[model samples]
Target chain A: MIRFENAHIGYDHDLIEAIDFELPNSGIIGLFGKNGTGKSTLFKTIIGLQALRRGNIFIHHQNISEIPGKLLAKKVSYCPTQILSYGNLTVWDVVSNGRIPHLSWLGKLKTHDIELVENSLELMGISDIKQQLISECSDGQKQKAIIASALAQETSILLLDEPTAFLDYPSKQELLKQLSFISEAGKLIIVSSHDLDLFEELCDLKLLLSHHKIITSEDTDFNKYWDEFTTKGLAK
Target chain B: MTTGKLTYLLLGLLLLVLFILGIGLGSADIGFMEAIKSLFKSADSSPEAYIIQELRLPRSLVAILAGAGLAVSGLIMQTLFTNILAGPHILGVSSGASLFVALTILAGSTLGDMSLPFAAILGALTISSLILFASRMLSSGTILLIIGVMIASFCSACVSLLEYYADSSALRSFVIWTMGDFSAVGKTHLPTLAVFVMMSVAICFAFSKGLNALLMGESGAHALGFRVKSLRTWILFITAVLAGSITAYCGPIAFVGLAVPNLVRFIVKTANHQVMIPLVLLTGACFGLLCDIISRLPGDDRTLPVNVASALIGAPVVIIILLKYQKSIR
Candidate 1:
């Protein structure tokens, strides 16, 4: 379980303050917010890249801020919004890097590591494209490759920022389905994306950040606020 | 054989052939058999032996070491910055070394035979650490690259100013140093340059896996549990030691550091640093030996500077790589 207690997170100052929430331990949580409303900052804080200015983050009942970087990596896998700039890596090579935190300093891959990488590629249905360079992979294939890499990390919580960006409509739906499947397999998957209706259909819960407060699907007036948001967006 | 292994075997054979030619076919042509025989004889045993042991052997080793050092350094910088244009000199490490050496030459400071090398390492470390610190403040790689170029130019301006104030003989010596030479490396200094180059190469291999992880960019590598800052620092340090030592010993040999990696990558067709590390080193040594042979102007008393030979070869190779990979550059 990941818990944020009165967390105020941002680059220089608070974009969102006094955030208190406990993410569902084993399910897909879709995070939605308008542009510039601290979604990325919140993700960074949870990934342990940014510090919470005022409060504490607990992971499995332990304070996250005190966790060492390598140890933290074993618990959370993060995929950024942008395609990685490296062009030379093959899909298999990229997946292999997911084992970095678990390997010795020399990064020698053992039989177990190789098996895990193969398993991840198989799980994502990217086994056929394993030898393809990342530069050659289609948007959907690249998205799957990235997810496979995250899975290869074997983290309990996977954080993806805009995983469906640049993906086609059908590819977006397919990716969300895969994400939901993975979540059901017992990992906490938190994703932020602009595909709202699809995200809502697939995610087990929603963490809606607006007006400097986080409102979850469990809140009493959650549907009323969600309908108000839809009306506001449609009115705009 | 696998492409990587074949590349190594061919490069190794080429380096051996070039090494033999480098020693045998100088301005004064000695027979191949005589050169080989003299290499094993004591330096004082014969005039041929003296030439082989004292002059030809050391110069050949220097060429190989400098070439390998510069090429490997360039590869590391290119990988670290994730930019093809990045080279040992681009980060101002070489320029900083040049500035200090220029000052030492102008001031006529004699700290025995080791003054120039010591001073160059000091200057390179100083500038590289500054760049490392600036990298923390500047998040963009492009901006950091620009900053490095600006620093290099600033150092060049300082060198020019020093040149403007220097006397005739000092200016001449400084100009020759800038032109670069493998021939200046003597029997006494070869061991030190050899030690430095070999040590840097070892460190690079030790960091090879981390370097592969780094190709994914900083945030990506950090997420993989890499200490990006420390890895970058070590890379800069290794580059400084390699480039700084080579500059001190051979006077800023160019193009080899910037071009060899690209050439190797094109031929080998893989991004695995495990394969690249050895290939680049061997290819670099071959290139250096070839450049030295071209510069020697066989049987003539006069010879061209090895730096000129390298740029003559390296510039075109880089241009070709850029043309083929234009879309990848940005």
Candidate 2:
């Protein structure tokens, strides 16, 4: 199981702490907090993208930092918000890149690898746009293409940062439906977003960041959370 | 800019025609038949054959290689920095090579022909390190670009200072070197140059996937499980080797380093570096060869520098790009 024990992350002067947690085995774990509460920092930490300031994170009885970078990629695959700026790539090319972890430094693709990419495209309903460039797709199709990439990673856990930010009604619903299918395969999903209504609809458990630390939704001070969020325009 | 399959197919054909034309015309002007014969090492000993082997062939090859390398470097740099204007010459690296080269000539080092390219390579490495240092200190991409330009301006001032103090003969050498010449390339350096260019171009080809992973920006590549820093560093290294070495040997021929990739993008309408890069390579080679020919058209010692011709070709393209697809390309 993944565990964050007193882990903290800081950037030059700002610091965000992870008090403690034993991540649940298999369900969506929603992250919610005020703007400066370091919700994004915590998600980045779990993925090993941001360096920790103190304490350590462990995956399957081993410290994540100790694992080799390639091995670590295999263990924890992440799906951030759909990248807005990537140009020139098709849905297929972007999705197939998820196999980077399985490939050697030479990075050649085998037949099984092609099958995985195809399977993922079909699963995400992105097969219709498989040859279309990423920039050419609509919002929901882009997000599904992003999910196809994550599914291609074939990991036990998926970590997404604001999976539904800037999405419209039907687009957000389409993404939520995709996420539901994803979480059904005993896959553990962690999504951080301020789309409270949509987020609450999909996530099984919720996490909140406050007081420079992470805590469960049950332990969070709702009045204070909403006050900081409302005042800071974070929860809106 | 309309990239229907037909447009791309026509563009591909147009590029191929330009490449063959490039491989065909040169200083000694061999007939197509004799030139083709010379490639197989069985030409008859006419002046045509000697000219084909000694002058035209190597000159054409250098033009193609240098053009392709510079264009691909610009393409990769533009992608890596995510700035539309990030060309190979922007960071003062080319000027760096020109600087030490001017100094070497002023010193009358007698280091022979090879010393010039070597000195230029040294200058490129130094400037590249400076750019990397500036990047580390500066948070904003625009700031880093300006800082790099500031360094380039400083280097340019130094190049002018050397020109002012030098003897007439030395000054002429420095000026010719700066004008950039494919015709003057020594045969001895060609093999090493070819190998290095091919290897780095191959590296860029390999990184097409990684570069595409990067087209989404650094954070996006990270989420895709790439070591963004490692991949970016390698891209920089490859760009340097390709563009730096070409600038060192050929002087600062301009714009193919800046324009060809964008033209390829315009033609193909795909930013997939995999396809875009090879297109850049071919298109760059063809463009460079064409520019090299244009440099010779005035004749009678009125030959313009290749840089002047390229800037003519490039500036309009840049302006058009800015006016039209600037926002999306950026």
Candidate 3:
């Protein structure tokens, strides 16, 4: 489990504060917020990219701040929302990079590393397109490739920031379904999305970013936030 | 054969052929057999032997070193900026090196034979770090590119100021350097240039895996355990060393760094830096040797400047490759 204690997180100043929560080690977490809310910042803080303002974050009973980057990488994988154009990189090449921390300095992939890459590709159902350049992959396929790369890392905790932003409806559903399935494999998967319906239907837990605080609850309370989202939209 | 192996075989042959051509096809018109004999003989008193051993051999070595150095540096820059057009010269590194050379010339400061190159390296290092810090402040590649060009123009303006104050002799020397040549450094300097260039390439290969991870984007690389900021900084540092040393020796020879990696990428059709680095090195050396040979103009007593030859040769090849891979570039 990942536990946040009085977590105040942001880049410059605290965008959200008092984020006290314990995320179960194996479940699907839906992070939902308005455009300017601190969902991405929270994820960044947990993944050690952004500094926490005033708090302790513990991953698997070890303080996150004390863990080395490579060790931390082995435990948590982060997927950014924007996928930049990677010139000439095939799906296999991109996925293979996830084995970086696992490989030695020379980075000659071991047989097991290669097998993990293949397994991740198969898990993401992108084995057929493994040889295709990332630039040529469709938006949905590219998202899956990114997720496959994260999976290839074999981390226990996976954090994705707006993974479905540019994906179409079916693509979004497929990606979320994959995330839910991944959580079922005993990995903690946290995905930030605007898809309220999918979150209600697929996520085991939901964390709502509102008014500079994180409100956590089970999916039974998602309806409360849906009404809140629509009323806020109507008021605006 | 795979493209990689074929690229290796063809490049190796090209290097050999160009090495021979570089030695034999200069204005002296020595036979290939005579050049070979002269290369092995220590006491051949013939002017042909002297030229072959003293001038032509060092020039060939320097050409290969500078060419391969610039090409790999260009590859790293292209990867760092994620732009197909990025090169050693694009970020004003050459101009930065040139400005320092101008300062040393105009001031009449003497730092020994190695001082000028060291000064150039310092200049390149300073300017690269400035641009890197600017990258932290700005996110747009286009903005960073504009900043790099502006820095180049600024360095050129500084060079112009130094030129205005310089004596005619110093002015002439600076102008000659600007024109670019492979003949300036003699046998004395080749060992040092060879060592530095070799070390730079080694460092690049050591970081090739991390560099490959960088292609996935900075955050992605970071998540995969590569320190993106340090990686970028180290890349710039290595590029400065390679490019600065080349500029210090070869006077900022153009287009090899810009064009060679693009050409290699087109031929190989993969983004694996492990494969690309060695290929770029070999192809770059061959390309450089070829340019050096063409600059000699073989039969003509007067030869073209290497910069002009490189552009004349490299630019069109790059343009053709770009045209063919236009969609991929975007």
Candidate 4:
């Protein structure tokens, strides 16, 4: 379980303030917000890339700030919106990098680690492209590869920021389906995207960012909350 | 064997041949067999043995050290900044060394015979510390790169101004040093150069995993549980030590650092540092030996500068790589 207590997120002044929420251990929590709405900042804050301005976050009752970075990596994996294309790294090489936290000081991939990397590629249905260079992959393939890397981390919590930004319509739907399957396997996934209609179809819970606050809604009434959010001019 | 293993084997064999060749062919006319035989004989056994033991061996070893050191330094900088164009000299470490060397040469050297290398190292470390300080204040790698360029330009300008006032002999010697040569390191200084380069290379290998993680950029590496800030600092320090020491001994040997890593990446077709690091070391050693041999020009006593030979080879390779990847680069 993840819980936030009066968390203030941002640099300098708070972009989002007084964030208090509790999320179940397993579900797809769709984070919805317009551009520049602190979605990325919130994700960054949770992953410890950015500090909380005011309060605290707890993962499984352990304060996130107290969790060492290596330990936190085992608990939470993050996939950023844009992946810098390291020209010569193949899909397998990129995905295996997710196993860095679990490896020894030399970062050698043991047999088990290799198996996990293979499984991540298999899960994302990109096993065939494992040998292909990431720079040569299509947008959809690259997105899958990036997500597969996060999966290879084997974390309980995965956070994705604007994952569908560059993906085509069908690719986006496919990626959402993959996330849904991943969540079903007993992992908590918090994904941020502007695709509200897709979130309505797939997400188990919806969290909307409006007026520097997070408003939560159950799956059954997410459409109602989204409608209210959009119609009330709060999305702007 | 797999192609990767095959390529490694081939490169290793090539490096072996070049190592022996580097010892064999120089201003002296020792036959290849004689050179190989001299390797097992005592230094006092013969004139050829004495020459090889005293002069050729140290020179070739220095070449290997400088090549491997500079190449690995370039690789570290390239990965840290995530720019293909970055090299050992990118941070003005070489220029810093040059500035101090220039001062020592032009200012009528108060310090004795060891002054130039000492000054070079001091200058290089000073610039490295400045870059490290600036890195703390500025977050962007691109900005740091610009700062490095600015530092290099300032150092070069200082060097030029010093050149303007020096007497003809001092100016001529300074110009020759700028052209670079592998023969400057003798038996006495070989151990120091070897230790610095080997230590830096070992440290680099130890951080190969972190370097590979950095391929994802800083935030991505952080998410993977590596401390990006500390890693960057370590990389800078290693680059400084490697570049500083190599430039101190070899007088700013150019192009090998910038070209060899790119060539290895192009051949290996992978950015995994664990695989690339060793390959780069061997390729760089071969490249150094080849450049040294070319500079000597086997039949002729008049030797060309090592920098001219390296640039002649490296510039074309860099150009071809750029043209081949022009679309992506654009």
Judging by DockQ against the true structure, name the best candidate. 4
Where is model 3 chain A poorest over a 10-residue stretch in terms of lDDT? A227-236
TM-score for all models, in order of appearance? 0.92, 0.87, 0.94, 0.93
Where does model 2 sit among the CAPRI classes?
A: acceptable
- Per-residue alpha-carbon lDDT of model 1 for B8-61, expressed as tens digits? 788889998998888999766689889999998999998888999899999999
- Clashes per candidate (backbone, < 3 Å): 0, 1, 0, 0
Per residue, candidate 3 scores C-alpha lDDT tens digits across B57-95 of 999999999899999998988888777667878788888
Evaluated on chain A only, model 1 obtains a TM-score of 0.94
For model 4, the TM-score of its B chain against the native B chain is 0.89
Ranking by TM-score: 3, 4, 1, 2
Reproduced native contacts, each prediction? 0.34, 0.24, 0.55, 0.56
Write the residue-wise lDDT of candidate 2 on B203-292 in tens digits: 898887688777655565776567888887787777777776787678877778777877776666566675687778878877888787
Q: Give the Å shift of residue A129 in candidate 4.
A: 1.9
Question: What is each candidate's DockQ, to 2 decimals?
Answer: 0.47, 0.38, 0.60, 0.62
The 10 consecutive residues of candidate 4 chain A with the worst lDDT sum are A217-226
Model 1 error, position B322 (Å): 0.7
lDDT of 4 by residue, B1-330 (tens): 299889989998998899898899877789999998998899999999998999899889988888888899888877766666667576787899889988887878632257766787788878877876786687566688788889999999999899998899889878888888888778888888898899989999999889988876666787888778888878877787888878877887878877999888778777888888999998998889889988887456778889989998999988887676543331
User: Which regions of candidate 2 fall more than 4 Å away from where they truly are?
Assistant: A12-14, A82-92, A108-111, A118-144, A218-234, B1-29, B41-44, B109-112, B132-150, B299-302
